[model samples]
Target: MNEQLTPRQLMILVAYFIIGTTILVVPSALAAEAKQSAWILQLAGTGSGLMLIALYVQVFKRNANSNLFQINERLFGRWIGKGISLTIALLVFVFCAQVLYYIGRFVTTQIMPDTPSEAIHVLFIITVVVGMRMGIPSIARTAEIYFPWVLLLFIFFILFIMPDIRVNQLLPAGEFESMSLVRGALQVMSYSFLPMFVTFASLNAAYDWRSSMAKAFVYGTLLSGVMLTVLVMVSTMVLGPDNTTTQLYPTYVVARKINVGNFLQRVEVIVAFLWFILIFIKLILYFDVVIMGIAETFRITKHAKTLTVPVGLLIAIFSAVVYPDYVYQQEWDNTTWVAVALLIGLAYPIALLFLSLFRKRKAAAK
Candidate 1:
C-alpha cells in the first residue's frame, strides 16, 4: 500500500520544518552580525531561499516519482549513488542529533533547569521514532491536525507583543555593514532554507508532485520566512539588538514581555509550545530522511521499522556529544554548519540535476 501526502500536508510540513530551530534563535544569530538590520537580512535570506527552491523544483521535475535516494541511484548509478545516499543518511543523522540536543537544552535551560538534557533527548526521540514508525502520511496528518492551533497561538503571540514593539529600536536600520548582512543572511539560510533539501526525501509521497508540490514548496517557504522575519523584527524591536544578541533564545525572551492588562501573564509557555511543535516535526522529518536513505541504500526496508528504536537511541546518545558546550555549538553553527549545509543542500542537488540533464541529452543524441 502506497502512502500519499496531500499538497496541503506537504506545505504545512515544509513551513513547520523551516521554522523549526530558526524561529527560536534567529534573532540572536542575525542581530550578532546585522545588528539593528537583522530583519532586513532575514528578508534577504528568505528571498535567496525562494530562489534556491527553484533549483529543487527543477530536480524534482526530472524525477517526480522518485524519492531522493531513488533519484541518487538513478542519476549516479548503483554503487556511487548508494555511497552518496549513505553519506547523506549519515549527515542527516548527525543533524537529527543536533536538533534533539537543541530541544533537550532548551527545555532544561528555560523550563526545567534541573532536568537532565539526556533525559529529554531520550523521551523526545521516543516520540519521534513512534511517528516514524507510523510512516509519512500519519506524520503529515498529525502536522495538519495541529496547524490551526499553531496559527491561532501565533496570532495571539503577535497581537499581544505589538504594544511592546518600539519603533526607536529599529531606527539605526539600513546602516549595516555589507559583509555582516551577507554573513547574517547566510546563517539564516543555513538554518532555515538549506536544510529544506531534506524535503526531497518525502516529496515523492505527495499526491501531486509535479504541479501542486512546487506550489506547496514555494508557499510554505514564503509563509515560514515571513513568520521568521516578523519574529526577528519583533525581537529586535522589543529586546533591542544588544539584549537580543546576548540571549540564547531571544524570541523566547521577547515572549516574556507579552502582557495584556497584567491578567494574561507568564505566557512564555506559548513560545515554548510553538518551538516544541516545530522542532518535533523538523526532527521527525529529518529522522525519516535518515531512515529512508539508509533503508533504500542498504536494501533494508523489511527491517526499517524494527531498527527505529536503536536509531533513536543512537541519536539520543549522539546529542550529548554533538557539541561539548553551548559555546562550541554556537561557533559550529556560525562556521562549520554553513559550509556543511551548502555542500549537501546546494552543491549536491545542483550536481545531481546537471548530471541528470547530461544523461538525458546523451540518451536523446543516441
Candidate 2:
C-alpha cells in the first residue's frame, strides 16, 4: 500500500508518540527514585534520546524506501532479517499492550473508581480501532486538533498552581552520590525515551525524510522533556521528595493544590482530562506504527482495513495478561524492565549504525 500521508500528519504522529503514558507517570515515578534531582535524569534522557534519533535517522536515510522489516532483510539476508523483524514486532506489540493497560487502570482508579477497568480498556480499544481504520492522515489530523487543547489545559493548570509552589521543598539537603545520580539518570532515561524505539521502525514510510523527522524528534523530545522537568520541579517544590514519592500522581496532587483565591480548587479534573487526551493520542500513534509494521512484514495490500480491529482487540487482551496487577507492573517497570528498554532504544540503534557503516565499507571495497 502506497498511501502517502502529509508531513504535518507525520509530525503529529511523532509528537503523539513522544508524549504518552510516560508523561503521566514518569515524573512521580522518577521523583521517587531520584528525588529533587529527577530533572537531571530527564535532561540526560533527552540528550541520550537525541543520540538514538541520530542512529534511527541513519537507518532511515540508508533505506529510505524500505520499512524496517525490508531494511533488515536487505542488511542481514532473508531468514535473519525475518527473525529480527519478528522479534521487534513482538516487543512493540507487548509495549503497546502495556501502555493500553496502564492507561485503562489509571483512569479507573484515579478518575472513576466505580467504573471497571475492563470497560475503559474496551472504550480505548474502540477509539484506537476507529482511528487506525480512518488511516494515518486522519489520525495525524486528529492529533493536531487535540494536541493544542491538551497543551493549553496543561499550561493553564501549571500556571494556576504556581502560587502554591514551595521552592525550599526541592533544596538538595541530603548527601548526594554521583553513582546514585548516574543510576537515577539511567532509570529515568528508560522510562522517558526507551519506548519510542517502536516508532522508528516505520520511519521509512514517513514523509520529508531527514529534516522533518529530525526536527520532530528533536523538538518533540525537548518539549516533552521540558514539560516533564517542570512537572518534577513543581512536584518537588510543592510536595517535597517524601510526599512526592508517596503520591500516585504527584502532578495531579499539585493540581489539587491549585486553589486561587479559594475558588479554583479541584483542577485535577482538568489535568486528568488532558492526560486522557495525550495518552489516547499516544496509543493511537503506536497502533498506527504497529499496523504499518505488520503490513510491511507480510507485504500485505490494504493492511490498515484488515488489521485494525484484530490488532486493537489483541492489545486489549494482552494488556490484561501482561501484569498480574498494577503493583507488579510498577515493580517491573522500576527495575529490570526499564533497563532492557534502554538497551533496545539506545544501545541497539547505535549498534545498528556501526553495523551499517561496516556493511557499506565492505560493499565499497568490492
TM-score, one value per model: 0.97, 0.92
Any runs in candidate 1 off by more than 4 Å, and if so which? 205-207
lDDT of each: 0.86, 0.73
Q: What's the C-alpha lDDT at position 149 in model 1?
A: 89
Backbone N/Cα/C clashes per model: 0, 0
Per residue, candidate 2 scores C-alpha lDDT tens digits across 105-144 of 7788788999987788889889878867776667677777
Top candidate, metric lDDT: 1
Instruction: For candidate 1, write residues 95-208 as lDDT tens digits.
Output: 999999899989999999999999999999999988889877888889999999899898899999999999899987798888987888788889988878865554464446
Q: Highest TM-score among the candidates is held by which one?
A: 1
